[model samples]
Target chain A: MSEKNKYQNRRDFVKKVGKWAVALPIAYLGYELIQKTSAQEFVWQIDPYKCTQCGQCETNCVQTVSAVKCMHAYEMCGYCDLCSGYLRQGVKERNTGAELQLCPTSAINRSFIENPYFAYTIDEELCNGCGKCVKGCAAFGNSSLYLQIKHELCVNCNLCSIAQTCPAEAIQRVPNSKAYNLKDGYKPKES
Target chain B: MNKKILYILLFIFIGWNYFIYGQARFPKPEFDSGYNYPEYQITEPISPVWEYIDVAVLLIVLTLTTRFTLKTRSRKSIILISAFSLLYFGFFREGCICSIGSIQNIALTLFNDGYTLPLSVLLFFLIPILFTIGYGRQFCAGACPLGAIQELTGIYPVKLPKTVETILSTVPYIYLVLSILFAATDSHFIICKYDPYVGIFRLNGPSTIMIFGILLLVSGVFINRPYCRFLCPYGVILNWVSRFSGKHLTITPDICTNCRLCETSCPYEAIIPSDLLQEKESMVKSRKKFIIYLILLPIITVGGIFFLQMFSENLAMVNQKVRLAKELRLEKENEIKAISIDAVTFKESGSTLEQLFLEEQQILERFRKGTPWAGGFLGLSLGLALLLTTINRKRDEYKPDQGKCYSCGRCFEYCPIHLEKLELK
Candidate 1:
C-alpha cells in the first residue's frame, strides 16, 4: 500500500477502534446488568441468621482486628432490675462492682428498669466472641445475648481459623441475605 | 545411531518430567476449606514447568534486546537456556496470571472496604513498569507468559491492517476497565479466569474454557499469542503503568539511528515509531481523536454494559447445587428448632444444641455463596476486545520509542540493527 493508504488505513483503524471502545463497555455492562438482575440473589452477601456470635472471630481473623463483632436486638430486652449480661452490682442497689460484671472488656451496659428490674445492652467494639455473658445469661437468665461476625473488621478470609477452631463450631460463613440475626430474641440489623 | 537414540531418550525423559510429573490440580478457593490468610499464600503459584519456560523465554528476549548493546555471543547456549526455562515453566510447573493479582490489589484500594491490598500486587506492577520505562515493553517481548507464548510460536508474524489493529488494541484498555470495575465491585478477577493458555499449563479447570485455550494455541502457531496482543487485561494495565514506570530498557539514543528494523521485529507492535515528519499533524489529530473517542466511548460502553448485564442475569444464575445447599441449611436450622421445641415438651429433645449446629451451618453456607467467583467474565471479554483492536497496524514499517524497552531483548535477537551492531563490534 502507498504511504497515503497506510496513513488513511491507520486513521480509519483508529476510528474503528474508537467505535468499539464506545460499543464494548456498553455491551459488558449490559451483560452484567442482565446477569445481576436475572439472578435470584446477589453473589456476595452476609447471612445474619447462621452466625453464632463467637468471639474467636475477633483475634483469629487475618486483619489486625477481626471484622466480627456483637450486634444488638434492642426490641427483645425485658429490662430487668438485675441485668445478667451487665454489672451484677446494680447502681444505687444497682451500684457497680468489678466482680458483678459479666464481660471481660466491660463492653456490656446496664440501665435502670421498672422498680427492681434493670435493662441491659452490649457495646460492640469492646465485645469479643468469648461468649461469657451469653453463657452467664443463658445459665441464670433469659438467653437474650448473642454473638455476630461484623464484616467491617472481618477480612473475609477464604478459610477462617476461628471457624476451624470454634469449640462450639459456631463460626460459619453466611450468604448476604440470611446473614444477620439467627436468634429468637431481639434481632439486630448486622452488616 | 546410538547417540541419536540417547538424545531422543534424553528429550523424551525431559519432556515427560516437564509435562507430566508434578501436575497440580488446585481446588477452587472456598470459605470452608480453612485456608484464608491472603498474604504469601500461593493463590496461584507459577508451576515448576512454567518457571523453566519463563526463564527460557526471558533469556532469549533479553539476548535479542541486548545483542545491539552488548556483544554478539554464540546463539547455541542462549537457545538452550531459553528452551530449558520454557520446559520448566510452561509444561512442568504451569503458568498463571501472577501479574493480574497485583492489578486486582491496586484496583481494590479504590473501594473502601474490608479487603486490604496484598504486597505481591505492588511487586508485580513495579517490576514491569520499571523495566518498560527504560526498555519499552520488552516484557511483552519475553518475560510475560502471554508474550512468551507469542514469541516462541514460529509463525510468520502478520502485520495487521492498521485499521484492524487500531480497533483490536483498544480491547486491552476496555479489559482493564472491566477488570478494575469487577474487582472494585468485589467480583473475581476476570483476567485470571478466562486465560486461554492457563489450562494448558495447569492442565485443569473447566474444560469448556479450553476451547479458547485451543484458539490461543492455534493462533500462537499462526502468528503469535493473539491473547497477549489483543486481549490481556493485565497487559493493558501493565502498559499504562509501565508508561510512568521508572527508567526501563530503551533503545539507546546512539544506537537506534531511526532504523526501522526493530519495528518489524516487534510482534506486539508496542514499539511506537517516532513520527518526526508528521509529528505535529499526528499529535493534533491524535489529540482530537482522543477527545472524541473518550467522550463518545464511555456513554456507549456503559450503555452496552447495562444492557448485556441485564440480558445475562437469568442465564448466569447460581447452580442448582448451591441452591440446594441453601435449602438444606434452612432445613437443618428448622430441625434444630424442632428439637428445641421437643425438648421443651418432653425434656428429652437435644433441640437447642441441634438448632445451634444447624444455624452455624446456615451461616457457613451464606459466606460461601457471597464469595466473588464470576466477576471476571466481563473483564475477560473486554480484554479480548482490546487485543483484537490494538494489534492491527497499517504502517508498512515498525518504529521504536527512545525509551520503554523492557530489556526482553527480542529485537537484538532478531533485529538487523542488532546484527549490525554485533558486526560493528
Candidate 2:
C-alpha cells in the first residue's frame, strides 16, 4: 500500500509539472501579446483627397443607408451665392424653392450668410454619401464638399465593403485618435 | 487674398496643421459679420471603453465556460451560455470581436510593420488558447459566438463518414496557410471576404455573402458546425492544443460496462469506442507504411511548390492593380476599344502604363516570395496526415477523443453510469 501511494504521488507530481510546463509559457505568451497590443482601436476611414466621387461609397456600405456622409471644409469654402454643390449648373433661378438642387435627397442645406455669400451645410441624416454634391463642387465650384465615413454610422467590418468596390481605393483604416482625413489638414472645431 | 491669387492655390496639405487652407479656388469670403465657423461634430467610434467591457465580458464568459465544462458538466447550462453568446457577441457586438479573423491580423503583423494589433484582439486570440490548453476546447463549447451560432442551429446533425470527415478536416489548415499568405502579401483578406455568418449578424452585406451565410446556416441544420469543423483556421490551432489538454470529458463517469449505449451518441464522431483491435496491422507492415510516407514528405512538399508556383500570376491577379494593369496592357497592345473608360481613367490618373506594369511586377514578386511558404505548409500538413494514418493507439474503454470533442456534453446523458451518478447525487 505504501509503495502504491508513492507511485501515485510521483505520477501526480509529473503531471502537475507537465501542466505548468505548458501553462506557464502560455501565460507568458498572453503577457507578451497584451504588451504588444494598443488600447486605442484602429478603424476604417475614407481619405477625402483620394476619393473619386465614384458613388460606390453610397451603395456599397453594409449599412442600408450607408455610413459615408458629406463633410464640408468651412475654411476651404468660397461660400458663393451660386454654390454649385447646392444648386445645379445654370439654374433658372437661385432660390430656396429652385428645382435645380444637385443632391438627389436635397441633403445640402443652403442659408444666406453675408451679401453674395451662402453657408452650405450638409444634413447627414439624408446625405446618403452619394458624392453628387462632391462631384458638382469638384467640377464647377470650389471642392469644399467631400465624403467621409461617419464613425457613429460605420460598423467597421473586418473588411470594409466600400473599400472592396471603391474605384480609387480611398477607404482605409486609420488610428482612432487621428481618424478623419479632412481636406487641407482641416479639423472642424469641436464644441 | 483676392479671387485671382486664390485661383492658383491648391490644398496639398498632408498632415497636422489645422489652419492650412487651399483647394477651394474661389476667394475666401471676407465676413465683417461676427459669425464664427460653425462647430461641426464628427461622431467618434464606439468607445474603447466598450472594448474593455467586451474583453471583460469575454473573460467572464470563458471563465463560466471553464467552470461548466469541468464542474457542472451540464449541456443545458452550455446551451444557456451559447444563447447569451449568440445574442451578445454575435448580434449586439455585430460579430466583429472575432478570434477567427484575428488570425489574419496576426498574419498581417508578421509581414506588415505598420499594422498595430489592438489590445482586445490580442486578448481575444490568446485567452481562449490558454483555456483550451487546460480545459480541452471549453471555449468552443460555448464561448465563441461563431461556434455558438452554429451549435444552436445544429438541430438534426448526422454523422458524416470517417473518410469524408478526415478529408474535410484538413481544409482549415489549407485555409489558414492561404489566408496567412494573402494577408502577408497584402493581397486581400479572403477569410473576411468568405465569412458566412457576419452577413447574418449585420443583416445586410454584398448579396453573395448574404446568400452564402443563409445557405451555410440552412445546411448547418444537419452538418453540426460545418464551418467550425471544416473552415475555421483558429479551430485548427485549438484542435492541436486540445490534443494535449490536461483534463478532458469522458463518455462515462465510471467504468464502462461494455454495453456500448453511447457508441454513436456523438454526432461529431468524437467518441472513440474501445477497440477489439480487430483491424490492427502487424508491426512490420505499419512500420513499412510509415517509412514509405516519411520518404514521400519532401517529394510532396517540392511538388506542392512546383504546382502552386505555376499559378502565381493567377493568384496575383486578386490584387486590383495587377488586374487593371493586365487589362490596360492588353488594351494598349491591341488597341481594341477606341476609348475604353478604364484606359482613359488609367491615363488621366497621371500613372503611365510603365508604372502600372512595374507595380504589377512588384505584386507578382511578392506572390513569388510568399506562395512557396503557403504551398509548403499545405504539403507538410498533408504529409503528416498521411503519416498519422499509419499509427494506431490502443483504447481500453469508450471515451471522447480529446481534440475532436467539442466538450458540449451532449453525449453525457447517454451514459447509464453518469445517469446513475446524477440520480444518486
Candidate 3:
C-alpha cells in the first residue's frame, strides 16, 4: 500500500475508535434507561374495611370466576365453644353437622375452648363470598365474618364489574395505604 | 429463497426468544388501586427475541465493517450476515425508547413538571444530545429498531423524489419542538403514545397504537420505516448526538471513485451520485435554503402548534367522528318514535337492548378517536415537515445523527470505509 494510503488508514482507525468511545456512554445510558423505566412494579391492594362480604364480588366479575375470595381473621376469634356464628338456632353445643354450620361448604372449624364457649376459624379455599356465615356472625356473635380480596387471581380491570354491582354499595375503592384491613370492629379515622 | 427462509426462521426464533423472555421477565402490570396504579405504570417486558436480534445486528454490522476496512475477499458474506441480523432484529423487536421517542419523551418530561424528572430519564436526554452534537445520526443507522428493520427490508432500493424527501425530513424536527412545547405545557408525549412499532415489541399496550404500528409495518414495505425517517421524536435526539460522534459515516473525497454503487445501496436517497453532485451549482443554493429552513422551521412549528392549541376546543367539537354514531342512534330513536307503533310491537324492539347497542357503539367510537390519526392534521403536517427538510448522505458522508442514532453501531459496522480500517487495527 502507498504511504499516503497507510496514513489515511491510520487516521480512519483512530476515528473509528473515537466513535466507539463516544458511543459507550450513550449505549450504556440507553440500556439503563430502557431497563429501569419499562416495567417497574405498581403496588396493589384491596381494602377489607369497605367490603361487605355481599357475595356479588364472587358472581358479578368479568372473569370466568371472580378473583375475589374471603379471608379469615384468625387472631380476632375469641375461641368460644358455643360459637354464635357457627351454631344453628336453638343449639347449645357446637356440632360438626352441616345443619349446625352457617357456612354452606362447612369450611368453618368449630373448636371447644371450654364448656359453653367455642372458637371458630374459617377455611379460605372453600369460602365463596356467600355472606351466609358473615350475616349469622354479625347478627349473633361479633361481626368477624367479613370480606377481603385475594389478588392472586384478580385481573384488576379498570372499572371493577363486581364493585359496580355490589348491593349494599359496600365495595368501596380504597388507596394502597390500607389495602387489606380486617373488618373486625376497627373503625378508620377521617383524614 | 433458502436465505430468505433462513432469515425468517432466524427472525422467528429471535421473536420467540423475546416473547418467552418478556413473558418470564415482565408480566403485565397487575391491578393497583394506589396513586401509582395507572400513573407509575410498569412497561410490559418486550419480546426476548429482540435482545438476541439486537446483539445479532450489532455483531453482523461489526463483522461487515471489519471486512470493508480490511479489504477482505469474504466481504460480501460479512455484509450479508450484517444485513440479515439487522433485518431480523428490526422486524421482530420493533423499537422503543427509540431515539425519536426518547428525544420527544425527555424533552416533554423536562418541559412538564419542572422538578419531577427522574435521573434515569435525564440521562436518556443528555447522552443522546451529546451524541448528536458529536456524531450525526448513528441511532437511526444502528440502535433504532425501527430503522434497523427498514434498512434490512430495503432490499430493492429506490430513491424518493427530492421534493418528497425534503418535505418529509422536516416533519420530525417540527414534531420534536411541538412535542417539547406541549410537554412543557403539561401535554403527554403524544409522539410516544402514537408510536406504531412499539406495540409490536412490547406485545400489548394501547390497541389503537398497535394498529398504527401495523400501518407503519405495511408502509415500511413501500416508503421505508417512515417513523424513523420523519416522525420519530427520538430521531431528533439521534440527529443531534450524531453531530458529536467524531467518526461519522461520511462520503469522503478519497472513497469517491465517481462510481454511484453506494447510491443504489441507500433506500433513503441520502446519497447523491457523483454525476449529480458535480453537475449541480444547486449545492450552494441548497445550503442557503437549509439555513433559511432552520430558522423558519422553528417558527412554523411553534406557530403551527400555537394555532392548533388555540383552536383545540373548536377542533374537538368538529371531530364529527366522535359523535357520529351517537347522533345516528338518536336519529334512529326519533324515527322509531315518529312511527306510531302498537305498544306490544314497540316492546318487542326492546328499548333496553337498543340502549345497550348505543352504549357499545359509543365504546367503539371512543376506540376510534384514540387512533393515531385522531390528532389529524396536526400530526400529519409535522411529520411532513421533518421528512422534507432532513438531508443525509452515505459514502460521500456517513454522518449519522447522534440524537437519532440508538448507538446500535450499524453505520460503523457497515461503512465500507470503516470496515477497511478495522482490519489493520
**DockQ of each candidate's interface versus the true one?**
0.01, 0.46, 0.03
Q: What would the per-residue lDDT of candidate 3 be over residues A1-191, giving only the tens digit for each residue?
A: 97757766875786577567667766675565543343222212335433445566656654334555544444344445555567667875557888777677777776554444455666666766666666566555545555665554543332344554443335543443344455443433433
Ranking by lDDT, best first?
A: 2, 3, 1
lDDT of 1 by residue, B310-335 (tens): 53323222222222334444556765
Going through the candidates in the order shown, the clash numbers are 129, 1, 99
lDDT of 3 by residue, B236-273 (tens): 54554453455444443145444444444445554435
* Model 3: native contacts recovered, as a fraction: 0.02
- The TM-score of predicted model 2 comes to 0.88
lDDT (tens digit, per residue) of candidate 2 on B1-425? 68655554533233222233325468778898766777675877777778778888888888898777678777889899988988998899988868888877767765776777888888888878888877889888888888998999999978888889988998999889888878877777888888889888878777888998899999899989999899999888788777767787777777887678898788888888877634577888999999999999988898888877888888888876777888887777996653543455566678777888998898899899888878887788788879977875555578787778888888889889889988999
- TM-scores, in order shown? 0.43, 0.88, 0.45
Candidate 1, overall lDDT? Answer: 0.48
Clashes of 3: 99
Best by lDDT: 2
Give me the candidate number with maximum DockQ: 2
Q: Which ten residues in a row are the worst by lDDT in model 1 chain A?
A: A37-46
Residue B14 of model 3 has an lDDT of 74
